[model samples]
Target: MSTPDTTQHKLIVLDMAGTTVADDGLVELAFTAAAERLGEDPATMIDYVRATMGESKISVFRHLFGGDEARAQLANLAFEDAYGELVADGRIAPIPGAAEAIAELKEQGRTVVLTTGFARVTQDAILDALGWRELVELTLCPSDASGRGRPFPDMVLAAFLRTGAVDDVRRIVVAGDTSYDMLSGVRSGAGIVAGVLTGAHDEPALKEHGATHVLASVAELPALIREFPA
Candidate 1:
């Protein structure tokens, strides 16, 4: 609700989907499209797909679609095809003020890191669309030194390591939009857990999951960073 005190906050971590990109119903559309493509029950798979907000495309698909090989194939095909359609249609854009936020964080001598369940290939397209291919300092995907993904904290720790920041696991802030993002932040013992409603989850859901701070969007980040009473 309040702008976090970030004037001296050396690091800022970001979530990709709602935090940065305009998904245009991509997540849900992927599952529905995949189900139709695979000739399966979309209802049975909805739970897994919705639950996969913080998982890699392959991991999520594998869990939802069932089986390893089929999951990988389906994920690759579904995501690639969906993305291709999205690109061809050309409505994707970075969330408002996202690039500006990244740029300002750098201007303030802060190291900006992006961690997402999205794959590197998918992430590349989103970043390129956002015009942020060179604006960040770490992590193209959830995998780090540890292959583990979100809700496990490996990626968060990886960001800290890459930035050469405090690894005490107590001075980092993980800001995101999904419950999985909150879980990842808390599981990692990030000093702060800031959630935004711009993504799939709302403020109430974020609080239910362990977010101590909730902002309207990443656009309010600078204000949050500059005014926290901490």
Candidate 2:
């Protein structure tokens, strides 16, 4: 009997905001604007927002509003609008070499999927701003994966099922810049959960959360993937 080839990672799932796109505090700024617009004080929630950087925005709002679905929906809308406007202003940029790394991954016959915690509208706006509408074969928002995002393996599993890239979940590679990203990857049973330092959390937080490897930036990811044992 022949054994399955399990050496190479075939599916790559990457986070959008902090991993590939350099938002530079736009999420916090948008949260503040949204809170102010909703007649709430940003101070009461900014810390939570910062702490849960890679979580679904609507999920955050749901918690902040104490499960008031209406308020959470409103807040999520306002936050998405504020974020879309900032993206329109060109406040976000691709992390240096992020695009190249993705391209290289694709060139190597690996499937790349971009996942974000933002709503579909905001995710689209950021992609449009970066001219990355087609950068990867798939781009997922929390909504795309049954409305679940990081800290829950929904998006990662969604990518696995939707792309049909690899037969084994252990062949998936998940990369991001936050601890939640690490948790999601871990929950999904991915082969590698790599945390990059170009965004929210630091090395210790990522490592503590479940990151198998810590990198300086997404730019180093291609080489890491290539050098990973088969």
Candidate 3:
């Protein structure tokens, strides 16, 4: 939902991996499993996996499989198998202060949309665990959309549309941990683009890519929102 002001909306879109969840160990695990399927070293394959953080799972898998549809599909099966087991075993949880930040946004009457590169299978459970299912009004996962994911503004534009923030871009604040997230926010004409170091990039990298604000993590979001004018 939007603010009561009615003059413009107050929208916040959050990214998953580095922004909301700490997948450092799970990511490494998935890489190891997928690499085994490819007969490669998990350590050697990490760069590829981490580089695809802001992309759809299929996109990431496809890259790992050398863009071959058949191999990508096979590798994806293995990766998901490993990741699913990890989640089922209580090995994953929301990042520090993630749930609190989203709750604060909602309490302030802002529309908080979750945009991620995760497929529904992964995102649904994550949201469910974090008890954030009802707090969000929109969820845009790449598997459900068109165009490239991040660095293309596809999901950002889609979030704006479904959240009714398209007309009031000034009230839009897109936050993520990847350079792709920052660049996509800029391309989407968002009023604010904040980057978090807890994700895949650092403060300097985020600023170099045109972030309006760079914070340590999503934990700092409530303060930032409060300081921003209505």
Question: Stretches of candidate 2 above 4 Å error?
Answer: 1-7
- What is residue 217's positional error in candidate 2, in angstroms? 0.4
- Give Cα distance to truth, residue 160, candidate 2, Å: 0.5
Models 1 onward score TM values of 0.86, 0.96, 0.87
lDDT of each: 0.74, 0.93, 0.78
Model 1, runs deviating above 4 Å = 1-8, 66-69
Model 2, span 1-230: residue lDDT tens: 66544336889999998899999899999999999999999998899998999999989999999999999999999999999988898899999999999999999889999999998888889889999988999999888999898899999999999999998898999999998999999999999999999999999999999999999999998888888875
TM-score ranking, high to low: 2, 3, 1
The clash tally of candidate 2 reads 1
lDDT value, candidate 1, whole model: 0.74
- The window of 10 residues in a row where model 2 has the poorest summed lDDT is 1-10
Model 1, C-alpha of 109: deviation from truth (Å): 1.5
Q: What pairs collide in candidate 3?
A: none
